[model samples]
Target: MSLRPLTKFGYLGRTYKFFNGETLYPFGYGLNYTRFKYSMVSSSHALQLKFGRLQHCRDLTYEDGTARPPRPTVVVDDITCGKELDFEVDIQVQNVGNVDGADIVIIYSKPLVGIKETHIKQVFGFQRVFLKAGENKTLKFTFIACKSLMVVDKTVYKVLPSMENMIVIGDEELFLPVQINIASCQN
Candidate 1:
Protein backbone atom coordinates (compact mmCIF):
# COMPACT_ATOMS: atom_id res chain seq x y z
CA MET A 1 0.00 0.00 0.00
CA SER A 2 1.14 3.53 -0.76
CA LEU A 3 0.92 6.40 1.71
CA ARG A 4 -0.46 9.82 0.89
CA PRO A 5 2.14 12.61 0.42
CA LEU A 6 0.42 15.00 2.81
CA THR A 7 -0.20 12.28 5.40
CA LYS A 8 3.37 11.03 5.31
CA PHE A 9 5.71 12.38 8.01
CA GLY A 10 8.20 14.46 6.04
CA TYR A 11 10.89 17.01 6.92
CA LEU A 12 9.07 19.67 4.96
CA GLY A 13 9.16 22.17 7.86
CA ARG A 14 12.16 20.92 9.78
CA THR A 15 15.47 22.77 10.06
CA TYR A 16 17.34 19.94 8.26
CA LYS A 17 16.82 19.76 4.50
CA PHE A 18 16.79 15.97 4.40
CA PHE A 19 14.50 13.40 6.06
CA ASN A 20 14.67 9.62 6.43
CA GLY A 21 12.75 6.83 8.10
CA GLU A 22 15.74 6.04 10.31
CA THR A 23 16.13 8.29 13.37
CA LEU A 24 19.24 10.45 13.43
CA TYR A 25 21.20 11.24 16.56
CA PRO A 26 23.79 13.95 16.00
CA PHE A 27 26.97 14.20 18.03
CA GLY A 28 26.43 15.48 21.59
CA TYR A 29 22.89 14.19 21.22
CA GLY A 30 21.54 12.59 24.41
CA LEU A 31 24.77 13.68 26.07
CA ASN A 32 23.99 14.60 29.64
CA TYR A 33 26.11 16.49 32.13
CA THR A 34 26.37 16.33 35.89
CA ARG A 35 24.32 18.72 38.03
CA PHE A 36 25.92 21.86 39.40
CA LYS A 37 25.08 24.28 42.21
CA TYR A 38 24.50 28.06 42.17
CA SER A 39 24.07 30.37 45.06
CA MET A 40 23.63 34.12 45.69
CA VAL A 41 26.46 35.36 47.87
CA SER A 42 25.20 38.96 48.32
CA SER A 43 22.99 41.62 46.71
CA SER A 44 22.24 45.30 47.25
CA HIS A 45 19.20 47.49 46.61
CA ALA A 46 18.88 51.30 46.53
CA LEU A 47 16.72 54.04 45.09
CA GLN A 48 18.30 56.33 42.50
CA LEU A 49 17.93 60.07 42.91
CA LYS A 50 18.30 61.24 39.31
CA PHE A 51 16.51 58.27 37.84
CA GLY A 52 13.90 58.30 40.64
CA ARG A 53 14.17 54.55 40.68
CA LEU A 54 16.06 51.81 42.37
CA GLN A 55 19.64 51.83 41.15
CA HIS A 56 21.54 48.60 40.71
CA CYS A 57 18.85 46.36 42.16
CA ARG A 58 18.30 42.88 40.77
CA ASP A 59 17.46 39.23 41.58
CA LEU A 60 19.71 36.23 40.97
CA THR A 61 18.70 32.62 40.26
CA TYR A 62 20.99 29.66 39.72
CA GLU A 63 20.36 27.07 37.07
CA ASP A 64 20.82 24.28 39.58
CA GLY A 65 17.52 22.69 40.48
CA THR A 66 18.45 22.64 44.13
CA ALA A 67 19.10 26.37 44.15
CA ARG A 68 16.05 28.63 44.43
CA PRO A 69 14.83 31.74 46.24
CA PRO A 70 18.28 33.34 46.22
CA ARG A 71 18.94 35.61 49.17
CA PRO A 72 19.22 39.39 48.61
CA THR A 73 21.36 42.07 50.22
CA VAL A 74 20.88 45.82 50.52
CA VAL A 75 23.92 47.91 49.50
CA VAL A 76 24.74 51.60 49.43
CA ASP A 77 25.28 53.35 46.06
CA ASP A 78 28.00 55.97 46.51
CA ILE A 79 29.51 56.13 43.02
CA THR A 80 31.02 59.58 43.63
CA CYS A 81 33.11 58.27 46.49
CA GLY A 82 34.35 55.45 44.23
CA LYS A 83 32.01 53.16 46.12
CA GLU A 84 30.57 51.44 43.11
CA LEU A 85 28.10 48.70 43.96
CA ASP A 86 27.72 45.45 42.09
CA PHE A 87 25.66 42.46 43.24
CA GLU A 88 28.10 39.62 43.55
CA VAL A 89 25.64 36.78 43.03
CA ASP A 90 27.39 33.60 44.04
CA ILE A 91 26.58 30.47 42.07
CA GLN A 92 28.13 26.99 42.12
CA VAL A 93 27.84 24.42 39.33
CA GLN A 94 28.86 20.87 40.22
CA ASN A 95 28.57 17.61 38.35
CA VAL A 96 26.88 15.50 40.99
CA GLY A 97 26.02 12.77 38.49
CA ASN A 98 28.50 10.64 36.67
CA VAL A 99 27.80 12.48 33.42
CA ASP A 100 28.55 16.19 32.97
CA GLY A 101 25.99 18.82 31.95
CA ALA A 102 25.79 22.53 31.12
CA ASP A 103 23.61 25.16 32.71
CA ILE A 104 22.26 28.60 31.78
CA VAL A 105 21.99 31.52 34.15
CA ILE A 106 18.92 33.73 34.25
CA ILE A 107 18.36 37.00 36.13
CA TYR A 108 14.90 38.55 36.29
CA SER A 109 13.91 42.00 37.57
CA LYS A 110 10.39 43.38 37.79
CA PRO A 111 9.24 46.59 39.40
CA LEU A 112 7.20 45.03 42.17
CA VAL A 113 6.95 48.39 43.85
CA GLY A 114 4.88 50.41 41.38
CA ILE A 115 4.74 48.50 38.10
CA LYS A 116 2.42 45.74 36.94
CA GLU A 117 3.11 42.63 34.88
CA THR A 118 2.31 44.49 31.65
CA HIS A 119 4.99 47.07 32.39
CA ILE A 120 7.70 44.53 33.20
CA LYS A 121 10.25 43.66 30.55
CA GLN A 122 9.71 40.41 28.70
CA VAL A 123 12.43 37.76 28.40
CA PHE A 124 14.22 38.63 31.62
CA GLY A 125 17.95 39.10 31.11
CA PHE A 126 19.88 35.82 30.96
CA GLN A 127 23.52 34.72 31.03
CA ARG A 128 24.86 31.30 30.09
CA VAL A 129 27.49 29.77 32.39
CA PHE A 130 29.01 26.39 31.59
CA LEU A 131 30.27 23.83 34.06
CA LYS A 132 32.50 20.80 33.66
CA ALA A 133 32.71 17.48 35.44
CA GLY A 134 32.57 18.09 39.17
CA GLU A 135 33.22 21.76 38.48
CA ASN A 136 31.44 24.94 39.61
CA LYS A 137 31.43 28.55 38.47
CA THR A 138 30.76 31.64 40.59
CA LEU A 139 28.86 34.31 38.66
CA LYS A 140 28.13 37.98 39.29
CA PHE A 141 25.52 40.25 37.66
CA THR A 142 24.99 43.99 38.08
CA PHE A 143 21.43 45.21 37.83
CA ILE A 144 20.57 48.84 37.16
CA ALA A 145 17.03 50.02 37.73
CA CYS A 146 15.19 51.29 34.68
CA LYS A 147 15.62 55.03 34.16
CA SER A 148 11.92 55.38 33.44
CA LEU A 149 11.18 54.36 37.00
CA MET A 150 12.50 57.74 38.12
CA VAL A 151 10.42 60.93 37.92
CA VAL A 152 7.38 58.97 39.01
CA ASP A 153 4.93 60.81 41.20
CA LYS A 154 5.82 61.09 44.86
CA THR A 155 2.71 59.05 45.64
CA VAL A 156 4.20 56.25 43.58
CA TYR A 157 7.55 56.77 45.24
CA LYS A 158 5.91 56.16 48.57
CA VAL A 159 5.01 52.73 47.33
CA LEU A 160 8.67 51.79 47.47
CA PRO A 161 10.16 50.23 50.65
CA SER A 162 6.72 48.87 51.18
CA MET A 163 6.47 45.11 50.88
CA GLU A 164 3.55 45.75 48.55
CA ASN A 165 5.74 47.61 46.08
CA MET A 166 8.78 45.79 44.69
CA ILE A 167 10.18 44.23 41.55
CA VAL A 168 8.75 40.86 40.68
CA ILE A 169 11.39 38.11 40.67
CA GLY A 170 9.52 35.24 39.09
CA ASP A 171 6.12 33.61 39.47
CA GLU A 172 6.30 34.50 43.17
CA GLU A 173 6.93 38.24 43.31
CA LEU A 174 9.29 39.35 46.10
CA PHE A 175 8.95 42.78 47.71
CA LEU A 176 12.32 43.53 49.22
CA PRO A 177 12.38 45.80 52.24
CA VAL A 178 14.77 48.68 51.75
CA GLN A 179 15.03 52.44 52.36
CA ILE A 180 17.63 54.73 50.74
CA ASN A 181 18.17 58.39 51.60
CA ILE A 182 18.76 60.79 48.73
CA ALA A 183 22.35 61.46 49.78
CA SER A 184 23.29 57.82 49.94
CA CYS A 185 21.29 56.95 46.84
CA GLN A 186 23.46 59.04 44.55
CA ASN A 187 24.74 56.59 41.92
Candidate 2:
Protein backbone atom coordinates (compact mmCIF):
# COMPACT_ATOMS: atom_id res chain seq x y z
CA MET A 1 0.00 0.00 0.00
CA SER A 2 1.15 3.55 -0.61
CA LEU A 3 2.11 5.09 2.73
CA ARG A 4 2.18 8.48 1.08
CA PRO A 5 -0.89 10.52 1.87
CA LEU A 6 -4.03 9.69 -0.08
CA THR A 7 -3.86 12.99 -1.91
CA LYS A 8 -0.53 12.06 -3.50
CA PHE A 9 -2.35 9.74 -5.89
CA GLY A 10 -3.29 12.74 -8.09
CA TYR A 11 -5.83 11.64 -10.72
CA LEU A 12 -6.23 8.34 -8.96
CA GLY A 13 -7.16 10.18 -5.81
CA ARG A 14 -9.31 12.77 -7.52
CA THR A 15 -10.71 11.19 -10.67
CA TYR A 16 -10.83 7.57 -9.56
CA LYS A 17 -11.95 8.91 -6.18
CA PHE A 18 -9.55 6.65 -4.45
CA PHE A 19 -9.72 9.07 -1.57
CA ASN A 20 -12.06 11.76 -2.80
CA GLY A 21 -15.07 10.45 -4.68
CA GLU A 22 -17.64 7.97 -3.52
CA THR A 23 -16.09 4.55 -3.29
CA LEU A 24 -16.78 1.09 -1.94
CA TYR A 25 -13.71 1.21 0.30
CA PRO A 26 -11.07 3.78 1.24
CA PHE A 27 -7.73 3.88 2.96
CA GLY A 28 -7.37 1.93 6.17
CA TYR A 29 -10.58 0.20 5.14
CA GLY A 30 -11.66 -2.84 7.12
CA LEU A 31 -14.79 -4.70 8.09
CA ASN A 32 -15.87 -6.52 11.19
CA TYR A 33 -18.79 -8.82 11.92
CA THR A 34 -19.82 -6.70 14.89
CA ARG A 35 -20.94 -3.16 15.48
CA PHE A 36 -18.98 -0.55 17.38
CA LYS A 37 -19.76 2.89 18.79
CA TYR A 38 -17.39 5.73 19.60
CA SER A 39 -17.78 8.66 21.97
CA MET A 40 -15.55 11.53 22.98
CA VAL A 41 -14.84 11.57 26.69
CA SER A 42 -12.45 14.49 26.69
CA SER A 43 -10.57 16.45 24.01
CA SER A 44 -7.98 19.20 24.09
CA HIS A 45 -9.01 22.12 21.95
CA ALA A 46 -6.01 24.24 23.00
CA LEU A 47 -2.32 23.64 22.82
CA GLN A 48 0.01 23.35 25.82
CA LEU A 49 3.38 25.06 25.67
CA LYS A 50 6.58 23.05 25.62
CA PHE A 51 10.22 24.06 25.19
CA GLY A 52 11.63 22.33 22.11
CA ARG A 53 11.57 19.76 19.32
CA LEU A 54 11.59 16.01 19.79
CA GLN A 55 14.95 14.50 20.67
CA HIS A 56 16.36 11.07 21.55
CA CYS A 57 13.90 8.99 19.59
CA ARG A 58 14.64 5.30 20.12
CA ASP A 59 14.32 2.97 17.22
CA LEU A 60 11.13 0.90 17.22
CA THR A 61 11.82 -2.78 17.68
CA TYR A 62 9.57 -5.44 16.22
CA GLU A 63 8.79 -8.85 17.59
CA ASP A 64 11.57 -10.25 15.40
CA GLY A 65 14.01 -7.80 17.04
CA THR A 66 14.36 -5.59 14.02
CA ALA A 67 14.61 -1.85 14.48
CA ARG A 68 12.99 0.94 12.50
CA PRO A 69 13.99 4.59 12.25
CA PRO A 70 11.73 7.57 13.07
CA ARG A 71 10.68 5.98 16.29
CA PRO A 72 8.01 7.88 18.20
CA THR A 73 9.39 10.30 20.78
CA VAL A 74 8.17 12.98 23.09
CA VAL A 75 9.13 16.63 22.78
CA VAL A 76 12.16 17.84 24.67
CA ASP A 77 13.88 21.08 25.51
CA ASP A 78 15.44 23.34 22.84
CA ILE A 79 15.93 27.11 22.57
CA THR A 80 15.86 27.67 18.82
CA CYS A 81 12.08 28.18 19.04
CA GLY A 82 9.54 29.22 21.59
CA LYS A 83 7.30 26.86 23.45
CA GLU A 84 5.95 24.00 21.35
CA LEU A 85 2.26 23.25 21.52
CA ASP A 86 0.99 19.83 22.44
CA PHE A 87 -2.49 18.43 21.87
CA GLU A 88 -4.24 15.25 22.87
CA VAL A 89 -7.63 13.53 22.64
CA ASP A 90 -9.30 10.79 24.58
CA ILE A 91 -11.96 8.56 23.05
CA GLN A 92 -14.11 5.71 24.23
CA VAL A 93 -15.02 2.82 21.94
CA GLN A 94 -17.66 0.26 22.75
CA ASN A 95 -18.50 -2.97 21.06
CA VAL A 96 -22.24 -3.21 21.06
CA GLY A 97 -22.49 -6.40 19.08
CA ASN A 98 -23.23 -9.91 20.29
CA VAL A 99 -19.86 -11.50 19.51
CA ASP A 100 -16.22 -10.67 20.11
CA GLY A 101 -14.46 -8.76 17.38
CA ALA A 102 -11.67 -6.32 16.65
CA ASP A 103 -11.89 -2.72 15.50
CA ILE A 104 -9.19 -0.44 14.14
CA VAL A 105 -9.25 3.19 15.13
CA ILE A 106 -7.55 5.61 12.77
CA ILE A 107 -6.49 9.17 13.55
CA TYR A 108 -6.02 11.72 10.79
CA SER A 109 -4.88 15.33 10.89
CA LYS A 110 -5.49 18.36 8.69
CA PRO A 111 -3.54 21.59 9.00
CA LEU A 112 -5.66 24.66 8.24
CA VAL A 113 -2.75 26.86 7.27
CA GLY A 114 -2.32 28.18 3.72
CA ILE A 115 0.55 25.80 3.04
CA LYS A 116 0.48 24.84 -0.64
CA GLU A 117 1.21 21.44 -2.14
CA THR A 118 0.40 19.36 0.90
CA HIS A 119 -1.82 16.37 1.45
CA ILE A 120 -5.47 17.02 2.11
CA LYS A 121 -5.07 15.07 5.32
CA GLN A 122 -2.49 12.81 6.91
CA VAL A 123 -2.83 9.76 9.12
CA PHE A 124 -0.91 10.31 12.35
CA GLY A 125 -1.84 7.39 14.52
CA PHE A 126 -3.87 4.15 14.55
CA GLN A 127 -4.50 1.15 16.77
CA ARG A 128 -6.46 -2.08 16.75
CA VAL A 129 -8.31 -3.27 19.83
CA PHE A 130 -10.26 -6.43 20.40
CA LEU A 131 -13.13 -6.55 22.79
CA LYS A 132 -15.84 -8.95 23.86
CA ALA A 133 -19.45 -8.28 23.00
CA GLY A 134 -20.68 -5.21 24.87
CA GLU A 135 -17.18 -4.35 25.99
CA ASN A 136 -15.78 -0.85 25.97
CA LYS A 137 -12.32 0.72 26.16
CA THR A 138 -10.76 4.13 26.34
CA LEU A 139 -7.84 5.17 24.11
CA LYS A 140 -5.71 8.25 24.45
CA PHE A 141 -3.52 9.89 21.78
CA THR A 142 -0.97 12.68 22.09
CA PHE A 143 0.31 14.58 19.05
CA ILE A 144 2.71 17.45 18.83
CA ALA A 145 1.59 20.51 16.93
CA CYS A 146 4.97 20.69 15.25
CA LYS A 147 4.68 17.11 14.13
CA SER A 148 2.45 18.33 11.32
CA LEU A 149 5.06 20.82 10.11
CA MET A 150 5.52 20.34 6.38
CA VAL A 151 8.71 20.10 4.35
CA VAL A 152 8.39 21.53 0.87
CA ASP A 153 10.93 21.52 -2.01
CA LYS A 154 12.98 19.07 0.04
CA THR A 155 14.80 21.98 1.62
CA VAL A 156 12.49 24.28 3.53
CA TYR A 157 10.57 23.03 6.56
CA LYS A 158 8.02 25.43 7.98
CA VAL A 159 5.76 25.42 10.98
CA LEU A 160 2.55 27.36 10.62
CA PRO A 161 1.31 28.78 13.86
CA SER A 162 -2.31 29.62 14.58
CA MET A 163 -3.13 26.83 12.19
CA GLU A 164 -6.32 24.96 12.90
CA ASN A 165 -5.30 21.37 13.55
CA MET A 166 -8.18 18.94 13.39
CA ILE A 167 -8.10 15.46 14.89
CA VAL A 168 -10.46 13.29 12.93
CA ILE A 169 -11.58 9.81 13.83
CA GLY A 170 -12.90 7.05 11.62
CA ASP A 171 -13.47 8.60 8.23
CA GLU A 172 -14.45 12.03 9.59
CA GLU A 173 -17.43 10.55 11.40
CA LEU A 174 -16.04 12.33 14.48
CA PHE A 175 -13.45 15.05 15.05
CA LEU A 176 -11.87 17.23 17.72
CA PRO A 177 -10.59 20.74 17.04
CA VAL A 178 -7.27 22.09 18.33
CA GLN A 179 -5.42 25.28 17.51
CA ILE A 180 -1.65 25.74 17.43
CA ASN A 181 -0.61 29.22 18.50
CA ILE A 182 3.10 29.85 18.02
CA ALA A 183 2.78 33.13 16.20
CA SER A 184 5.90 34.42 17.94
CA CYS A 185 7.96 31.84 16.05
CA GLN A 186 6.42 32.38 12.64
CA ASN A 187 8.28 34.49 10.10
Q: Candidate 1, after superposition: displacement of residue 1 in Å?
A: 46
Q: Which stretches of candidate 1 lie over 4 Å from their true place?
A: 1-33, 47-90, 113-124, 147-187
For model 1 the TM-score comes to 0.39
TM-score on alpha carbons, each prediction: 0.39, 0.65
**Residue-by-residue lDDT tens digits, candidate 2, 121-158:** 77777888899999999998776666643222111234
RMSD of each candidate relative to the true structure: 15.2, 11.5
Task: Rate residue 41 of model 2 by lDDT.
Answer: 79
lDDT of 1 by residue, 1-187 (tens): 2221222444232211112134466211334546544544444455433332454432322323444442221232312222232222344445556655665554443333222212232223445656657666666554433221221222222122212123322222222322232322222
Work out how many backbone clashes candidate 2 has: 0
Per-model clash counts, in order, read 20, 0
